[model samples]
Each structure stands twice: as structure tokens, then as C-alpha cells.
Target: MSLLRRLVELLYGSDRALRRMLQYWAATCVLYVVCIGLVLVQVSRGMTDGETAHRLIVFGSWGALAFYALIRASARLGLKPDQLAVSQAVFSMICTMCAYAISGPLRAAVLVMTVLIIAFCMFAARPRQTLLLSIGSLAGAGGVMYWLQAHDPLRYPPMTELLTFGYLAGALLATALLSGEMSKLRSRLKRQRRELSDALETIRVLATVDELTSLVNRRRMHEVLEAEERRQPDENGTCIALLDIDFFKQVNDQFGHAAGDAVLRSFSIAARASLRANDVLARWGGEEFLLLLPDAAPEDARHVLERMAERVHGMPVPGVQGRRISFSAGLATRRAGEPFADAIHRADNALYQAKEAGRDRIVLA
Candidate 1:
């Protein structure tokens, strides 16, 4: 039993407290059947009467029903191993009391079942629940045993004299060991799960973000835009703004491509800072960006872009060589019946108008 306990601890770690409790219940059931079978064989030898056999079968059937009902109830509740342990412990106490009533050598079975229950409660349930259930199970079992002895002295003397004291001591010792192991395993599993979740979130962020500008990349931007487009014609509104750096190539030619890259990155940071949390900013390509604005009208988008342009102009970019960095923006609002492509085309044309009208401004078509 000590070796088995050690092996269980090694295999399950701390998070497996609930699992171990369920295993204990299952093992108890199997052991009960074997013990009952041995009793039946010995008690029925050379007795041609079917009366004893029939009674034993009836008792076994009732026990089976009780076990099945508890298991089914636990499963329905989505009971974790820890919960199962508490439930099974309660059920085991009831079974032990019933055994006392039957005047059977079910004493061994009840003793084993009681010990397993205590182990589960101590190991699987939370500290408060463990203390509560353990005390409750112990008191309940003791009360039932006392009641049985009072009601029918002959039927329960063995339980009071032999089974009760031995089982209680065994239960307390087993519970102490199981509880310690279970707590350790639970702590370890929690740390492992937290680390795993953090790693997954980091991976997701890296996949969707632009490394240089720290904005959503082109692919992620498209995905977000498409999702917004699908949600249109609903109560919430949607708009897209296409922005291009005005005379960006001139800056690249005069200063260097590195300086031009710095300007693009700085402009992206400014644009992102100017937008609301719901707004999605992404690098569309060289010197171009797309913003998907949910719950925004063409007027609202125009206001947002105007604010973004103002912020960009205010920012200092070393690559701009003493000149202010500026952009042309096209704003398009989704019509109730219009396709996403049509809205995009309208925004593109509006952007052209902004460029055509001496640049550095927002144009709404």
C-alpha cells in the first residue's frame, strides 16, 4: 500500500488528486465484489437452500445501484476528481452503515471504503471543504454505527468493537499522507499551466504584430477588416481609412531609405496613438497603412483621420530632415447594402483626391 501510494504520487503529480480519489473508489468497488464473492462461496457450501444466496444477491444488487447512482450524479455535476472524492466519501459512509444493518462480514469492505473516502477528502477537496467533509463523514459514520448498535445490539457489535476504531485510525493516517501529496501536485500543475498560457499568448502576439512599428501586420489587418465587413448592416457601423505617406519617395531619395523607413515607423506609432482602442492599424505596404474602424460613420472616420494627421505632423522624425512628416487619407463608410470591395474602392478614390488636392489632408468620397 505504501509503494502504491508513492507510485501514484510520482505518476499523477499534484493536479491529479481528484483522479486518484476516483481510482480509490473504483478499486474499493472491485475489492468489495471479490470479498463478497468469497463470503458467498463459504457461506453457501453444502447448503442446498437458495434462500441465503438470494439474500446475498439482493444485497449486492442494492450496493451496485447505490454506487451507480452516485457515479451518475457526480458525472452529471461535472465533478472534478476532488469533488468525486468528497461525494464518494459521503456515499461510502452510507454504505458502511448499511453493511452494519445487514449483519455481514461486509465489515472489511466498509473499513476499506471508509479509509479510501477519508484519503480522497483530505487529498482532493480544498482545505476548508476537506476539513468540513472529513469531520462530517467521521461524525455521520460514528452516529450511524451508534444508532445501529442501539437499535439492534447483535447486528452491530462487531462494527463498534473491531471495524469502527480500526477504520477511523487508518482513515486519519491515510488522509494525512494523501493530502500532502495532492497539495504539492496541485501547486506544480498550476505553475505549469500558467507558464504554458503565457507562452501561447506571446506566440500569438509575435505572429500578428509588425516587428518594426509594433502595429498589426498586413495579414492581420485584412482579417480584422473582413470580420468587421461581415458584421455590417447590423446596429454597429464600420468604416475603413486608407492612408499613404505624401511624397514619401522624395524623402527616401533626399535622405536615404533607412531614414524613410524611420519616418514610416514614426508615422505608424503616431497614427496608432491617435486612434481609439477599437480601431485597428496595420502596415498595408511601403509607406501605406489601413485602419479598420468599427462603429464609426464616414464623418467620424474623417475626424479620426484629421486627428491622426495632426498628431503625425506634431511628431519629430529624424528621417524627415527638418520637414514635417505628412500623409493623405481616404475615408469610406460602409453602406447598408454595399459590398466590402465597393467601400474599399471608394476609400481608395478618396485617398487619391486627398493626394490630388496638394496632399497632407483627409478626403471623404
Candidate 2:
């Protein structure tokens, strides 16, 4: 089992081809073992000549040693799948030729091994390689048949040899064509899977992120608030705040909408810089935003918001002159796993109170 695993790693290197290569190697080993055993049984029964008796033992031993050497070399020097596939094809052809030579013309059943080699090539090699291997296999087999017919006409008659060679060549070429079509389909499926994964990731980002301010959008903000409420224990604190830009419409009225956009971007940058790493700022609507401070009491939330307000007031927008950006805020601390909607409602009322009293102030609920 360990030897089989090593062979898979060396040949396919974790590709989808690994499983097919394992099956091929297992089948090849079984073929050799069964054939060698059968031939030895035939020798014991006195069914074959002394010359034919040597063929199976010699060929089986040679194949075992050659494969052991191939495995060792593959480990010492990393051989890619294509390189290993070509090497296997070459080795199989050499063994087939040796089998034909030993069996003689009349008992050349060893030629069927070429069919197995061609079948293995369908999965292991690319389309071009399969075609080339098929052609090479056909040529080798035809050469063997021609040699037998010319040298031993009584054993291998010309008409019978022609029909057998034609069928063998046709089967090999047909297998190559079918394998090429399957390879193309596999490649297309892999490409489609990758493209679909990328598209889904893109959609998720667009849904959560604001296009203009690069902040979390309102819909995602509600989800975050609800999650935070669930996470807070009875003893822990969760602070949330809603803020509105002070007289933002006046800014847009005096300076065009483009300048208003610049102001919003600048405010987002300044507020983000003033807050802690764990704090989350999200766009609630046009000229309105929400901020979340996890594990923070009402006082801690107020201090953070005050610092943010000062920072935002000092920050200057590029297109607006003689004006400083300021925002009115309302903050509420949830009590013992309080619902998010209840806390946000209190914050909204506090925000209205601040707006009525004066702009650019924080009122706690």
C-alpha cells in the first residue's frame, strides 16, 4: 500500500489523475502475475517447448526489476505525469516485442498486451500523446506481423495476418479519438467551477460594502447589530449610536452635490481614525450613519463619540471653504441582552432631542 501511494505521488502529484493511475498500475501488476503463473503451469504440464518455457520467467523477472528501477528513479528525480506516461508506453512496447520474439509466429498471443497498453494511454496521456502512442503501437505490431509472415510463411499466413493487423490498428485509433474528446470536457468543467467561485465572492462583497464611502452598508449594519446583541451576556455591555451630519443639506445647497460627496468621504476617514480597532462604522442612509462599540458601557461610548466628533469637526473637505464638518449623535447602551430594535429606538429619540436643543452634540439614552 505504501509503495502504491508513492507511485501515485510520483506520477500524478496530487492531480485528479492519481486515482486512474493507481487503478492502471494495479491492473498491470495483476496481468503480469496471472500470466506468469499460467505459463509456469503450462510448463509443468509439458504443454510448451523448452525454448517457450524460458520466455515467461525471463520476461516476468525483467519487468519486475525494470519497474522497481523506474520507481526508484522517479523518487530521486521528480518525473511529471506526462514524462511518466511516455516512459510507461515505451516500456510496454519493448516488453511486447520481447514476448513476440520468444513466442514465435504460431503462438503469438502476446500481441494482445498491446491492446491493454493502448487502453492505459487513454487516461494517462494527452490527446496528442495518445494519437502518437497509438500510431507507434500500430507500427510496432505491424512490423512484428510482417517479419513473422516473411520468415515463417507456414506458421503465419499473409491473408490472416493482414486482417488481424487492420483490426488492431483501427481499435487503437478509435480509442485515441474518444480519449481526446473526454480530456476536452474535463478541462471545460474545471474552468467553469473556478469562474463560478469567483463570481459568488464578488456578489457577497458588493452586497456588504458601500460603493461611495467604502464602509459597511445599512443592511449589513443591522445584521451586525443583531449579532452583537445576541453575543452580549447579562453582565457585559453593548453600545450603539446613530449620527447625522449637522446641516448637511446646507452644505450641498451652497457647494454642489460633488462637494457634499467629498465631505462624506472625509468624515468617514476622520471618524474611522478616531475610533478603536473593534468599533464598526456603517452608512445608515444619506447623511446618516451608525457606529457599534462592543463591550462598552454608556460612558465609554460617549467618550469615544466625543473624540470622533472633535476629529470630524477639525477635518476639512476639499471643495468647501469657511465651514467645518460636524455631526449630531445619539448613543444607547443595551441592558442584559436587550433587543437591538429597542436600543436603536431610544437612540433615535435621543438624536431628535439633540437636534431640537442644538446641533453638533451627543445625547445619551
Candidate 3:
């Protein structure tokens, strides 16, 4: 387990993209080890120059290790590793070209290394990026083949290099096309995730908001009350007001339900505009609104509702030609050691009194 933690620390990545790049670098380092082992075998068989192969192996191994450390160091300094993987691919290809320039009869081994580097980049880079890399690899290898054939065509045969070039071109082109399709799939999944998140937000709004008045619905108000009930007692006190529109049914009967709806919408806008930042007003039921004011004394709560009443009184009914609307409110402050429902019950009693003693007045409990 400790060794595993050490390996993860060596990667030094906290995000997916950078971690993937680090992992890819680690894989290429392993490939480097295998290639170095192959070079040692070619030395034993006397197939390649001993001094040139040894120098390539030593420097290539050091370069691979240094690349890993550089990526880790830069990530700690907040540099993103998105483009660094491409640089590694290009660097490894250049190293492979250097090896190919001196591999004699073992040049095919260096060509295979080029293939693996570009194939690894196919997974990391976009289609256009991978395509450009494929072309670069082809050019590098072609240049090496041309130089070898021009100077020493005895061991590096023209026919063999031509066949090798054709084979590599086919493999790199196929990898590029497949990478393009994979890039498209990744983009589609991201878009689908964004669309799903937006749909969830819309559903939440529909559940909590009233359609006609654009105020919080009864279910959501119940949630707010429950939350307040769980809170510690405040200094001034928490207050709730129950408001009912006066003669609402008479208005609906005299001028259709649509006009009544417009009156409710306009009244809701006016009432909401009069509230303080911390106050929450919800449509408790038809023609009824409940306002919750946290840390408010009864006097302060009454004053705010009275102001709301004046605003509602002056607001013109939207569909009705020349009519205006007014509301009556019952304000109650929560007492210590009392349940919130009991306080609201007292407010309901006060609201009944306000209705009986001619509507459009504020009653306190």
C-alpha cells in the first residue's frame, strides 16, 4: 500500500486530464526500458554499432525520466499538462529518428518505436493534432531512410525502406481517423451531461414555484418553515404573517377567473417588492400568502405587512378595467419554547379576527 501511494505521488496529478498525461508518460518510459533492452541484445549479436547504441540508450533513458519529473514539477507550479504530452511524443519521435540514423540492420526496431509513440499520442491528442504528428513521424523516418540509402545502400536496401514507409503510413493514418471518432464521442458525452444538469434545475423550479403568481408554492414554504423550526432562537424573534385577499371570490365571480389570476399576479409582484432581503413570501393557497421574516419583532413584522398592504391597495388589477386589490394580514412572533405550528395557529386566529372586523387591516398576535 505504501509503495502504491509512492507511485501516485510520483504522478503528482489531481485532475483527470493531467493524470492521464502522466500515466501515458509512465507507459512510454516502460517502452523505453524495453527498447533499451533490445539494443543491448543487438550489441551482443554484433548487429549494431556498440558505442552509438550505448550512447542512445543512456541519454534516452535519462531524457524519459527527466520528462516525468518536469511534468510533475510544472503541475505543482499550476501549469496545465494538456500540451506537454504532445511535446513528449515529438521528442520521443526525434530520439527514434536519431536511433534510426545509426541502427544499420536493426533500423526496423526504431521504426516500431516511432509507431508506438504516435499511437500513444492518438489517445491524448485531437484528430487534427494526431494527423499532424503522423505526418511529422513519416517525414522524420523518410528523411532518415533517404540519408541511409544515399550514403550506405548496401545494408539499408531501398526496396526494404520503401515497404517499411508504406506500412507505417497505413498504421498512423488509421490511428488518426479512429482518434477523430473518439474525440466526437467525448464531446457528445459532455454535452449530454450539461443538458441533464439543466433539466434537473428546471424540475426543481417547477416543484417549488407557483405557476400563476411566480411565488414559492405551499410545499416549498413548508420546507422553509421546517428549516426555521430547527434553528436556534434568534435575538429579536422570528415572525410569520398570513395574508388573505379581501372579497377575492366576489372578484372572480364578477370578472372571470382569468382576471382574478391577473390580480393575484400583480398583487404578488407588489407584495414581494415591499419585502426586505431576508423575508420570504409564498403562495400558501388560493388568494392566500404566507410571509416569513427571520429575526423580526411583532412590531417590525406588522410594519412591513402594513406597507405591503398599501402597495397592494394601489396596484391595478391586470385584466379588470378599473379595479384595485387589497389584503388583510395576521402577524405573529414566535415565542420561546413554542412550536412554529402553534405560532402560525395563533396567526390564523388573528387573521380570522381581521376578516370579521372588516378586511384590509393588519392584526397582531
Best by lDDT: 3
lDDT of 3 by residue, 306-354 (tens): 8898888788776787676888888888888677788889889989999
Q: Candidate 2, which segments miss by more than 4 Å at Cα?
A: 1-77, 89-124, 314-322
* Deviation of model 1 at 75, angstroms: 24
Q: What lDDT is reached at residue 63 by model 1?
A: 64
* lDDT per residue as tens, model 2, 1-365: 59999976775466454545545655777777776675666556665465665765686668655764554455466765566676777777766765665454424567677777777776667889888888888888888889988998787788778887888788788888887988898789889988999999888878998888989998899888767766764545888899999999999999999999999999999999988879999999999988899988888899899999989989988999999889999898877757878888888888998898898999998
Which digits, one per residue and each the tens of the lDDT, describe model 1 over residues 257-313?
888989988898889888987988888888888888888877887888889988999
The candidate that wins on TM-score is 3
Backbone clashes, candidate 3: 0
Q: Rank candidates by TM-score, best first.
A: 3, 2, 1
TM-score of each: 0.53, 0.73, 0.83
In order of listing, the candidates' clash counts read: 5, 0, 0
- Give the Cα lDDT of each candidate: 0.71, 0.79, 0.83
Determine which window of 10 residues in candidate 1 has minimal summed lDDT.
46-55
What is the clash count of model 2?
Answer: 0
What's the lDDT of the predicted structure labeled candidate 3? 0.83
